[model samples]
Target chain A: MRMDKEVVNPIIDTILGSITSGLNSLQASMEPYLPELSWVAYLAFAIYVLIILAGGFMSILCRNLVRAMMGLVLTFLGVAGMYLLLASPFLAFMQLLIYVGAVCVLIFFAIMLTRNVSDGEEAHWPTLGALGYGLLALLAPLGVIGPLIIMHAGKIPVQVPVENPTGELGEGLLSDYVLPFELISIILLVAMAGAVYLAFRGFGPEKSKRHSK
Target chain B: MTTLTFFLLASLLLLAIGLAGLITRRTLVGMLISVELMLNGAGLSIVAAYKSTAASDVLGQLATLFVMGLAAAEATLVLAMILVVHRRFGKVTTKEISLLR
Candidate 1:
């Protein structure tokens, strides 16, 4: 009986451990390929970085609003790639889905809805007065904050990243972060409802006619 | 892979660009876009901090997720408000929003 129990326990352990064992074997198999893949990873990292900077500048500098939206899309894509490089593929996907998918679409709708508003002030290039304002806006934050970030960024100590980050993240959401998780859902619900109410309130032909006149 | 400094610097630049845009953008939608950019920078910095120094990876990720949620909420409210402004004021430029000025 004792011998039979011992044999059954080992069998059960093997069945339960097979998933991890498979992962270990897979990692072992890919060990040689990893060194060869390093260059590709570096190239991808560089491309993503360039994409981010270009998109940011394009969004900020472009005169046309639609063109600026395109730049925003580009930046979101680059940021998603950066998240993947940070070893969080889950966050990367979320970034793409939420930012590029939902938020951009919302902005597009807003742009289309308000496209007829012809404001000559906005259409003109920055004048001398506005140029000084723009310069102050650009330089003030950079001057005050840039040096502090530069001085301290290098001082941070990096460690070996956690294994199974995605799974752990899921667990933490349910366990440690249950409160905020629920709060987010509630906030999303309220925001959507409020947006719908605001949009449709007095949103009929009468309001349109008044605006048209 | 890139170092933490690179990510931090990237995030800082993003924030600066976003701030500049927010201050200078004449339209409500343009300002909203800049706000999104700023929020993205904040998320990147938070994750970078977590990736480098934090003991709990989940906390940083959770914060980023929360930021995303708040951003979505903010965008929805702001876009709706923009629509209302356009309907009421016939234009959406910051300069013409006389109540604010």
Candidate 2:
């Protein structure tokens, strides 16, 4: 009893056809879920935007230096949230750790140390007109450049498969970016030293005067 | 529309406001607050770029780490300086501190 070739070929073909059709339907059923995902993304984005704007406004309008620092913290938090939406959890964590935790704390301490809480004299310059002009100047260029860049971006070819980006980033930093990194470190060191020197300058004289008085 | 773009824009706005404050504020503490705002903006932009590119470069994360380290150092030093300045001048306003003349 030999099996005929024609019979086996049809059976194999039928089975393969059924499997392909099943996969196709499965994909079809999954398509409806994409919009929901997009909507969630949009909602997260809107919230982040609001956070950034509110923070910015607070930093600008608050007269008290401490209040301004609080606003800055809010801004940082909002930015970190945006980072999470962007899909880089590592960066978001860094933002929270550095900007909110360390930097803001430093600003708060600086405010406490320098500000005379009981003194009622204002600490800000009256530059409303100049500030408005500066704001307009900064925003106008961004507004123009943003649209132009967005329009041109569609025609630009996006580099695909960024070629082991993490590895490349490290290599690039150690190799190509080494000079800039070192320079930045030097600058930071200088800033640190300069600030210390400036702060210490009048300390001895001021102490003597206070004691003599 | 993209998450990265949105974040970048937000950071830019923050930076702009910070710059304005830094320029217009006359107190040492007010300047420090402006600096904090600027730093926050930079952090946000880095995170957004990392997230949208979908590339696991982790460079943005590393950069943020460095920024934090710098911020800590900066805060300690700046606060100490502010304390000393206040003690010497009896006031922290930038205008009042200009006694060199």
Candidate 3:
């Protein structure tokens, strides 16, 4: 027992000692350079992530349709904040306008159209059974996949960006991305028309008759 | 330890939550909401990758913008379809709307 303790304990101590000293060195090296503003920024990012988590939970788990829509609004806003932190202010603005403004409005309108759609219990499924299945589906794959990706992530790719942030966005869109830009606009127009037609189709005289038949 | 990895991991967690929500929710709208969460997770991951590896390339943000645009279009059409289903069947739960199945 004494020999086992001496040999095994020393091995474990060396491993733990290396990890602690490595972490300490890293902390010592970084402490001098990290600015006070970084703390605020990190704090904001933390808040944004929390908002996103709460919003997602509220939207998914809420029993009321209106509350769910509200949660969705918060989630979009939180996503927009994350975009800002990513240094893509333009994308962040687009997120606000497109997701928070347009998509949530669409959901709200649908909920109003079908009042009492959320009348039943949160779900008809047996709650515990569904939770178990849902957790099993998500956790099982993540358990198998997470370690694989982490193992590969150690290749540690390094890329240095050559252009300015917003400038690159403007140039990229106008020059290399012009075709896709116009194509997306066309797609939007088509989708808008289709949505309008589909939404109003049953209210139309001939379409209503056809649908009924 | 980098902020980039933090957001990426958060996005993955959000995606997992969304999948769980999709499985648990019986309502069509609820499922759609879960899908939205998943899409947001994808967009966040892309942006995180962009911020970390290619800060100058606007492609990542552009991809996210495209995702938002697609989400807008998808939500519009899906909600419209939901409206139609409600009008037709007077029910919104997955169990009741299995006409094709």
TM-score of chain A of each: 0.69, 0.62, 0.70
Model 1 lDDT per residue over A1-213, tens place: 356887899998998689658756765677653322344455676898899889987887777777788899999998888778777777888999999999999898888888822343345566677667767877777788777776774455565344345788889989989999999999999999999999898666677776576
Q: What is the C-alpha lDDT of each candidate?
A: 0.79, 0.65, 0.75
Any runs in candidate 3 off by more than 4 Å, and if so which? A1-37, A117-126, A157-167
Which pairs in model 2 have colliding backbones?
A86-B51
**Candidate 3 per-residue C-alpha lDDT over B1-101 given as tens digits, one digit per residue, 9 for 90 to 100:** 34555677678767876887789877777788888888988998888787667443577777787888888878878887888888778977788888972
CA shift at A207, candidate 3, in angstroms? 4.7
Q: What is the DockQ of candidate 1?
A: 0.43
lDDT of 3 by residue, A123-164 (tens): 344478887998886786467656655555524543322224
Docking quality class, candidate 1: acceptable
- Tens digit per residue, CA lDDT, model 2, A23-70: 666656765432223444566878878987788778766776667777
Candidate number that wins on lDDT, 2 or 3: 3
Q: Highest lDDT, which number? A: 1
- Candidate 1 collision pairs: none
- Per-residue lDDT tens digits for candidate 2, residues B56-78, read 44566557656666666676677
Candidate 2's TM-score: 0.67
